[model samples]
Target: MNDMRMSPNLALNQLVAQRRAAGESLVHLGFGESRLPPFAPLMERLAAGATRNAYGPVAGSPEVRAAVAGYFGRRNIPTGADQIVVAPGSKPLLMALGLVVPGDVILPRPAWNTYAPQARLAGKHPIAVAIPEECGGVPDPAALRESITAARVLGRDPRILILTLPDNPTGTLAPPALIRELCAIAEEEGLLIVSDEIYRDVVHDPATEFLSPAEVAPASTVVVTGLSKSLALGGWRIGAARFPHGPWGEWIRSGVVSVASEVWSTLAAPMQSVAEYAFGEPEDIRERLRASARLHGAVAREVHRITIAAGARCRPPTGAFYVYPDFEPVRAELGKYEVTDSPTLARRMLDLGIVVLAGHLLGDEGEALRFKCATSMLYGETVEEQQLALDAPDPLALAHVRSLLERVEEGFMRLVP
Candidate 1:
């Protein structure tokens, strides 16, 4: 699908690779990968099941499905084996959902880039709505209503809204009240809400509540999550979706399965084994999630402080290991360097041996001097350092990460000045 949109993260990595090839000593803040170590048990499980050769069911293995159901149950969201669809990644599952659901897609302007393109590939228009000031994922309720009315007048049928909690670039989780308000609007508009809660488990504050759209509007909302971010399992390519229970749920599930049969067919046997273990909701997995969340939160906040101190405008990070920084505060200085746009600022960072994704890559205005900094990549060159930081009484005090933070702070200072 040449006309389809490519993922901005992937594109950023490509740029990083090109810069490295040119011998630039770049600080990679581009891709948002969890540089944490994977749970040893999951690796063991995969190794034990690596010998299976035959393809399993198109939907997924029964054991994995059951585990996913139990996993959701642990979160107070009731689900069953039939309600889950394990896929290569949540990205494909989302693409399939766009195809299954009718009408145009509604997305927050600065969102995960794939949402809009996936909708377009499914032959639906993608309508961008402005997000609320406090959150960067779900569209503001007022903007949502106005956008729908405007689209309807223009003869567009807006039927789906994609919400990313603890968003990719912004790293701010939508408040439960905000989710409830958006859910109410979705109900009124007869919209199907796709809650991309991939980063939900990575909440920095244990007390910050996360209310799934399905929890607020189960009748029409679907939840999508995977182990990629939280578990540093991006390479494993295991993800799942949870649909509401009903006739429509069955239809959606069937559609996803049908799409799976034509595409990936089934997740690898080894990855399926890992998925079963991860989705089983074991004590070990719980501990792993908690540790990962703590590490991500700690590192992301450090980057947030650095960027703000450098005179960049940004929101306080709530979850995920990212910070969206707007360099508009230093617009005058940036213009002096001929860096008046996101792309220009991105190149300038690269020239300074720093790498970050421009805000326009996440569907923001192209001319805005903004970008997403992924703090997870700052984990030192070895597992010992990461583990030590994770186990340290005060991770921020750990030398390795603190050094990286210092580098970032210095880099931003140089850029802005």
Candidate 2:
């Protein structure tokens, strides 16, 4: 416990701020925060709820819960307000899942940095399985079965499986076929699935088939999402979850609310107001999400191009705003700078005025020369500049945004030559 460091992304953001405050020209690609400005109507809603300050229901306000229910219902998952539970943020809901769910946890290797740590804090062992090559967020179907067997062999009760949709760090969505395959495995193993779909609304391509494990295995899967990413409301801390409608689901929900009662008590009143409006999928909110998705896809693709051109192997980001570039192809060249591993590679980039979270911190092998580059942070250093980038006809072509992109490209170039 004493050995654990702060969450890598948060810790990196702090480091970047400290460096910049001391006058370093740091290009922050470390944090996963969406740098977009908050929607105006949402702000009005927050203000409207400001005077209604009182502790709400432990699960959530009925209006907000219903809105979240509809949010899932529209996605083909039949949900009800009774099945929904809201929390300060999806992070707390996830940690509560870790605490209430029985057995050790199974995670996709190189997953969001918080998952394993949450599991440990919940007093559960975390079993990491490598992701499939085609995408991230879900474990390699083949590897998962073996890992489960190995865990049980070691007397570990492997019962809970956590998955990300449009995964963090990698920014890729698992295909529907893969989701179905993994769901089948979960059913076979009798494992409860905790699906973190926080980025589901941020998918770069709307036409791209996105499948949620809850849809495929509703009986065993619990779905969680929040307004943080799509609406850029991270600070508002509005998150909600949909449990399967049954005795088991009710049991899980009750247990989570119990944990919530002891921990966060309830989602703040004002944020719940924000969540109600956002989850209702109002027309303005829908349009804002579409535009934000376009911006994230565009900048992420550009960074992917730069990384590939710089001799790193990177998956084309299909969703979210991240690209996990593996620098293994340039091992020999990087060796010249003694960048033989992920930590060294990260340090090398930082020395060149670029900040990225080392892959190892997200559960990748330390020996791998890889790091997670968050393109969202490249929008701008100020809210006004970010709004301009968001509104530009061609954001990447905007002078300020272009200059930032150039800085990123220049940083990558330094890595190779």
Flag regions of model 2 displaced more than 4 Å: none
Residue 100 CA displacement from its true place in model 1, Å:
1.4
Off by over 4 Å in 1: 1-6
Tens digits of per-residue lDDT, candidate 1, 1-417, equal 655545768877887788789877778998888887777899899899889778999888899999999988878898989999999889899998987888999999788778777877899998999888887988989999999999999999999999998798799999988989999999999998999989988999889888888887887988899999988899889889998899988888899888889989998888989999888868898888888888888888888888888888898999988999888888998998999999999989877777888888778889998898888998776988878876776788888888887778888889867
**Top TM-score prediction, candidate number:** 2
Writing each residue's lDDT as its tens digit, candidate 2 over 150-257 gives: 999999999999999989989999999999999999999999999999999899988988889998999999998998888888888888989988999999999999
Task: Spell out the clash pairs found in candidate 2.
Answer: none
In the predicted model 1, the residue pairs found to clash are none
